[model samples]
Target chain A: MSSNMMTEVLNLQANQLNAGASASLEAVLNAPPEARAELSALMKLAARMKRWLIPVRPSSAYRARLRDGLQLAAGHQETHRALVETRPRVPQWGWLIGAAALGSAAGIIAMILRRRQTRKDASVAESAR
Target chain B: MEAEEQLIERAKRDATAFGELYERYVDRIYNYIYYRVGNHADAEDLAARVFYRALGNIARYKQRGAPFAAWLYRIAHNLVANFHRDAARRREVPLDDIVAVAEKRAGPSQIAEQNEDARVVLEAMRALPAERQQIVILKFSEGLSNAEIGKLIGRSEGAIKSLYHRTLIALRAELVKRGAE
Candidate 1:
């Protein structure tokens, strides 16, 4: 990037950064898709490393006052958790019945084994007697 | 009315509406401040204050142009504006912290280049004015748009554009100077 162009880009980016939380993203979206992607990627990167520029506090009582706004911006810049939840589509009852049947079969086999062992023990005792 | 409108209208009259508004904007506001403030605890406290102030005086809100977010930004802006004066703050991201963050994300070596570049850019951002600093963080870091920005700070779209441009120019100059330094 030419010095002048780089300056403009930097200025534009700074302005965007300073534009507060309310600036129209549509304008940013209007940027060439490549530029948009590049800008976003750059922003994301800077955001992650921002902690170095700003002050960090232990997550505790003094939470409101920012010691360094810019650095804090960087540190807190992570992938934002989605505000809305997407419900996953659940499957039908086939798996549920199959699981239940499998569990029931295991229980029945366990019972049968216990009974056979008890009968074997009783028969051995009677023979000894 | 928009969702913001619904939210604000309900909040304007009722306490639960106020809570709902808090719920809606808390993370966004918290994110905005957390990135700029550089600490989780401070961001949370400031965010609570932002909602507290908003809730306390919600009756004064006049909704003609812009959504509820503008008012919120205004509150956030005003809050952060005073924050700088109260404390002497350093504006450099420590290298150790970057390594720590990278280690948590992936192998440190793979993300070294990305980490350094981001650190440079963040330092440049820290060099900007509070107004500009807050705006840039909110837009880029927190990912809010211009219309939302305007509503938060109570500016017209055109005004927001002009201010945004000016702030960018100022920031770019700072970044260049920092690079040279």
Candidate 2:
């Protein structure tokens, strides 16, 4: 390849690492067979460097809000979490558990009072007889 | 086959499904951030912040006209921009920093090449206003479409592709002239 062509080829090679990578590669692959053959080794080298250097992966989570005021769900919140922190998210569950324990204890206390009343009633009847 | 559709579907109601998305993109985002910030500690922290911001704003995500990854990079670009803006540093990466990535991605010589690539790219990146680097990293390393990239960075598609192509030419010349050193 001429030096200018080499520069063009190398620049094209760089784009193979761009976000437009597939498009660029498709453009090349669709070219004449001679061109493809000529670029094959360079393509492989570019691919190798890309895979090694600028490997593409989505490591950041993207969130776009379409409408306002909708509550976003929380995820992977350890960003600023204290080592010993455990956040309570569901208020309903806490309320339910507390209410249930309270109800159970009230039931037991009511049962004890009823038993005492029955014994008092039996004693009053025996005294009357 | 359909990464975007799968991410959108899982992210719909399941909050933990967002974590799955986090798992999918964490390393790539980390590396991208690492490439920019040039440190693992900062990369990890920024990576977490990016996801945190995503979770905080998940309800606002619109999958139409934009791929999921682009939106995330948009957030990352903003955070890194703010980071550079508020810091003592000019966000210039030392050549040695690429060495850290070297051990994992390539051998010593390959590391040298990547380091050289990093030097060239980082200089060009730092030479650019923050806005340009935002486009460069997302377009080149993250492999986003110009339209997708434009949406994230708030530029027209025409402007993006042109800028992208121009940046590549500059990057190549810069690398060849100074990178192999």
Candidate 3:
């Protein structure tokens, strides 16, 4: 059989399986007689594959433990969130830091000017004397 | 959905509400992780982390009409990927573990045969590309539709169908190469 025909058959079988319909070995009606056995094998294999990965539940102990853990973590998170919501909002640290730097620079400049004035005043006093 | 959304809204600010959400999705997320990792211990740990991360980021969660479970699946997916990366090796599913989960009433010989087949199938499954492995797990283990799997993996439904078909083919080839009937 041509590859396209084979692909068509496989895809038809896939569509059936995906739709939650069982793809029995005899389900490949469109395939040529020569390819029917191979197509049927593939379909049967796909169905068996689905059954192999059966859904297994987590143990009750693990489930309860994880739930408790989430609760505790969520409690901490809620407390932190509440604190954030109720706490007074502060200005951005960048703005506050910029203001502090400007203030420090101004203070330093003022001190330097005052010292220069005092030195000038003392020199003037000496010159006057 | 309104109830779930209201629960999610409350969960953002209330711990107990989040607990309700936890109860609803714990099994599903666990089952997804269990199949991906093929073990319970790692599945439990990863499942716990998924909820923790989800809880931490609940405040940022927006209801965009995608199911809330999708977001949790994303978390589980990322963690499982990291687990594989960190382990730095592919771990085979223990045949005994698979057998233990089999039907209890089966005779010892039948159970042994079933376990061997399961082991072969799981080995082939693990050998597939990561995306294919994920497709198989979500489809078979979680019973998600192609559209649902597409949404979870950010693919269109058509893309999911193609990928799933290819995955099955690859799995069959792998099984045949392994001498599995």
Best by lDDT: 3
First chain TM-score, candidate 3: 0.57
Question: lDDT for every model?
Answer: 0.57, 0.60, 0.81
In candidate 2, residue A94 scores what lDDT? 80
Q: Residue by residue across B66-118, what tens digits does model 2's lDDT show?
A: 65766787788788877777767554565445664454656778778766655
List the lowest-lDDT window of 10 residues for candidate 1 chain A: A75-84
**Which whole-number lDDT from 0 to 100 does residue B84 have in model 3?**
86
Error of 3 at A27 (Å): 3.4
Best-performing candidate as measured by DockQ: 3
Name the docking class for model 1: incorrect
Score candidate 3 by lDDT.
0.81
Judged by DockQ relative to the true structure, which candidate is superior, 1 or 3?
Answer: 3
How well does model 2 score by local distance difference test? 0.60
Which window of ten consecutive residues has the lowest lDDT sum in model 2 chain A?
A: A62-71
Comparison by TM-score, 1 against 3, better one: 3
Q: Any runs in candidate 3 off by more than 4 Å, and if so which? A: A1-22, A89-93, A103-129, B88-90
List candidate 1 stretches off by more than 4 Å: A1-129, B1-3, B88-105, B110-113, B144-148, B155-166
Q: Is candidate 2 or 3 superior in DockQ?
A: 3
